[model samples]
Target: MDAIILQVLNGLDKGGAYALIALGLTLVFGTLGVVNFAHGALFMLGAFCAVTFKKIITLEQIVLSKTELSPWGTPLEIRTPYAQQWFGDFGNVLIEYSVPFSLLLAIPVMLFIGIAMERGIIKHFYKRPHAEQILVTFGLAIVLQEIVKAFFGANPNPQPIPQIFMGAADLGVMVGMAENVITYPKWRLVYLFFSLGVIAAVFAFLRFTTFGLVVRAGMSDRETVSMLGINIDKRFTIMFGIAAVVAGLAGVMYTPILPPDYTLGMDFLVLSFIVVVVGGMGSLPGAVLAGFMLGVVQSLASMTEVKDIIPGIDQIIIYLIAVIILLVRPRGLLGKRGVMEN
Candidate 1:
C-alpha cells in the first residue's frame, strides 16, 4: 500500500511536467493552427532563467584577508556572495530560495520571448503546410539549442531547492498509515500543487475573461470571429505568448528535479508531443487528463513486480499506450470533430 501511494505521488510529479508542456503545445496549435516544434525550447529557456538568477545572486567578491594567511602564501583569499554581503540575512534568504525567486525573472522574460517568436516568425507560417511548419520550427529549435550551448556549455547545471523545502515529508502519518511509511520529497509536492494552480489559472483565464471568450470563439471559427471586427490574430499571438509562459514556468520549477542543460528541452519535447497527440490535438482538458494517466501508468510500470513480468516495461509503456490510443481513437480521446482535418 505504501509502495502504491509512493508511485502515485511520483506519477503526479511527472504528470505535472507533462501537463504543463502539453498544455502549452495544445494552446499554440488550437489558437494559431501552427505546429510549433520550437515550443520545447521555451521550456529550456525558462530553466536557464533560474540558472541565471542563481548565478547573478551568488556572484562573489574575492579579497585578500589581512588576518589570515595560507601555508606558503602571503595572504588568504576570502570570498562572499554579493547577495549575502548586500542584503545580510535577507540576501541569505534570497540565495536560499533562489529557485522560487527566479519566477520573477522568468515570467517577463518568457512572455517577451513568446510574443517575439510569434510576431517575428510564427505569424508567417500561419497558413503554411504542417510539414513546413515542423521543418522551420525544428530548425529554430536547433538554433536556440545551439545558442544556449554556446553560452552555458553542454554540461548540466544543478539548481538547489530552497532549504525550507529540502527533505521528504511523511505523508503516511497524514493518511492514517504507519509512521514514515510513505515519504515523499517536499519539493515534489510543492511542484505538484504549483502546477495544479497554474493549470487552474489558465483554465479560469480562458473560461471567465472576455478575452478568453473571444479566444475560444476564434478557436471554433476564425473567419467568423474576424468578420465580427475582432482582431483575433493579435489575440492568438498573445495566446502564443501565454503558452510560452506556461512552458517556461514549468521548466523553471523543474530545475531542482532535473538539472538545467541545453538539451533539456529536446529531451522532453518528444514525450510532450506524444502526450498532446494522445490527449487530442487541441483539447486542453484532454492534455491534462492524458498527462496524469500516462504518468501514473508509467510510474506503476516501473515497479519491480511489473518489470519482472514485462521486461523494460517502464520505458516502452508510454509509447505503447500512445500507439494503442491512436489506433482506438483516431481523433484522440477528446479531440473535436473536424480538427486537424485540413
Candidate 2:
C-alpha cells in the first residue's frame, strides 16, 4: 500500500511536467492551428533561465592583496559575490532560492520569444502545410539547441532546490503507516502542488476572463470572430505568449529535478508530443488528464513485480498506452468531434 502511494506521487511529479508541456502545445494548436515543434525549446530556455539567474547572482569580484601572501608565497586574493556586496542578506536569500526567482526572468523573456517567433516566423507559415510547419519549427528547435550548447556547453547543469525545500518528507506518517515507509522529496511534493495551482489558474483564466472568452470563441470559429471585428489574430498571438509562459515556468520549476542540458528539450519533445496526441490534437482537459494517467501507469510499470513479469515494460509503457488509446478512441479521451478531422 505504501509502495502504491509512493508510485502515485512519482507519477504525479512526472505528470506535472507532461501536462504543462502538452497544455502549451494544445493551446497553440487550438488557438492558431500551428504545430510548434520548437515548443520544447522554450521549456529548455526556461531551465536555462534559472541557470542564468543563479550565475548572475553568484558573480564574483576578485581582488589581489599585495600585503597578504599564501603559504606558497603567492599574493592572497579575496573573492566576493557581487550580489552579496550589493544586497547583503537578501542577495543570499535570492541565491538560495534562485530557481524560484528565475520565474520572474522567464516570464518576460519567454513572452517576448514566443511573440517574436509567432510574428516573425510562424505568422508567415499560417497557410503553409503542416509538413512545412513541422520542418521549420524543428529546425528552429535545433538552432536553439545549438545556441545553448555554444553558450553553456553540452554538460548538464543542475539547479539546487531552495534551502527550505531540501530533503525528503515522510508521507507514510500522514497516512497512518510507519515513518519513512513512504519517503518522498519535499521538492517533488512542492512541484506537484505548484503544477496543480498553475493548471487551475489557467482554467480559471480561460473560464472567467473576457480575453479568454474571445480566444475560446476564436478557437471555435475563427471566421465568425474575425467577422465580428474582434481582432482575433491579435488575441491568438497573446495566447501563444501565454502558452510559452506556461511551458517556460514548467521548465523553470523542473530544473531542480532534472539537471538541464542543451539536448534536454529534444529529450522531452517526443514524449510530450506523444502526450499531446494521446490527449487529443487540441483538447486542453484531455492533455492534463492524459498526462496524469500516463504518468501513473508509467510509474507503476517500473515496479519490480511488473518488470519481472514483462521485461522492459517501463521503457515502453507510455508508448504502448498511446497506441492503445489511439486505437480505442480515434479522437482521444475528451477530444471534441471535428477537431483535427482534416
Candidate 3:
C-alpha cells in the first residue's frame, strides 16, 4: 500500500515535467504546424537562467577577518552574497528563495529566445518540408547547446530550494494513516502544484480571454482568421513565445529536482517529442493527458515486484507504451480526426 502511494506521487512529479514540456510543444505544433526541435533547448536555457540568477545573488565580497586566522597564521577571508549584505533579512530571504525568484530572469530571456527563433528562423521555414525544418532546428539546438557549454562550462550545477521546503511532508497523518507511514518530499509536492498552476493558467488564458479566442480561431482556420483582418502571423509568433516561457519556467522550477547541466535540454527533448507523438500531433489535451499517464506508467514500471517479473521494464516502459499506443490508437487518446492522418 505504501509502495503504491509512493509510486503514484513519484508519477505525478515526473508527469508534471512531461506534461509541461509536451504542452509547450502542443502550442507550437497545434497552431503554427512547426515541429520545433529547439523547444528542449529553450528549456535548457531556462534552467541556466536560474543558475545565472543564483550566481548573481550569491556574488560575494572577500574581506580579511580581524579576529580570525587560518591554521597557517594567515588572515581568514569571508565571502558573502550581495543580496545578504545589501538587504540583511530580506537579502537572506532572497538567497533562500533564489530558485523561485529566478522567474524574473527566465521569462524575458525565454521570450526573446522564442521570438527570435520564430521571426529570425522558424517563419522562413513555415512553408518548407518537415525534413528541412527538422534539420535546421536540430542544428539550432546544437548551437544553443554549445553556447551554453561555452559559457557555463560542462559541469553540472545544483540549485538550492527554499529552506522551508527542505524536508518531507507527512501524508500519512494528513490522510489518517499512522504518522511517517507515507511521507513524501515537500518540494516534490510543491513542484506538482506549480506545474498544475501553470497548466491551468495556460488553459484559462486560452479559453477565457479574447486573445485566446483569436488564437483558437486561427488554429481552426488560419486563412479565415486572416481574411477577417486578424494578423494571425503575429499572434502565432507570440504563441511561440508563450510556449518558450512554459518550457523555460518548467526547467527553472525543476532545477532542484535535477541539477542544471548543458545537456539537460537535449535530454528532455527526445522524451518530450515521444510524448508529443504519443499524445497525437497537434492535440493539446492529448499531449497533457499522455504526459501524466506516461509518467504514472513509468513510475509503476520501476517497482520491485514489477521489475522482478520483467527485467529492465522500468527503463523501457515509456517507449513500449509509445509503440503500443501508436499501433492501437494512432492519433492518440484525445487527438482530433485528420491530424497526422492518412
lDDT of each: 0.92, 0.91, 0.92
Predictions: Cα RMSD each: 1.3, 1.4, 1.0
List the candidates' TM-scores in order: 0.97, 0.97, 0.98
Per-residue CA lDDT of candidate 2, range 1-342, in tens?
A: 777878999999999999999999999999999999999999999899999999998899999888999788899888888988999999888889999999999999999999998998999898999999999999999999999999999999999988879999988898798878999999999999988988999989999999989999999999999999999999899899999999999999999999999999998888888898898889999999988888888999999989999999999999998888788887888888878644
Worst 10 residues of 3 by lDDT: 333-342
Model 3: lDDT to the true structure: 0.92
Q: What's the CA error at residue 13 for candidate 3, in Å? A: 0.8
The TM-score that candidate 2 achieves is 0.97
**Candidates 1 and 3 compared by TM-score, better number:** 3
**Residue 240 in candidate 2 has what lDDT?**
93
Worst window of 10 by summed lDDT in candidate 2: 333-342
lDDT of 1 by residue, 1-342 (tens): 779879989999899999999999999999998888998899999999999999999999999999999897779989999999989999999899999999989999999999999999888997898999999999999999999999999999999999889999999899798898999999999999999999999999999999999999999999999999999999998999999999999999999999989999998888899899989999999899888888888899999989999999899999998899888886778888778633
Give the per-residue lDDT digits (tens) of candidate 3, residues 1-342: 799888989999889999999999999998889898998998999999999999999899888999999888999988887788889999988888999999888999899999999999999998998888888999999999999999999999999989999999999898789988888899999999999999999999999999999999999899999999999999999999999999999999999999989999898998988899889888888888889888888999999999999999999988888888888888877888888854
After superposing candidate 2 on the true structure, give the runs of residues whose Cα lies further than 4 Å from its correct spot: 65-75
Better model by TM-score: candidate 1 vs candidate 2: 1
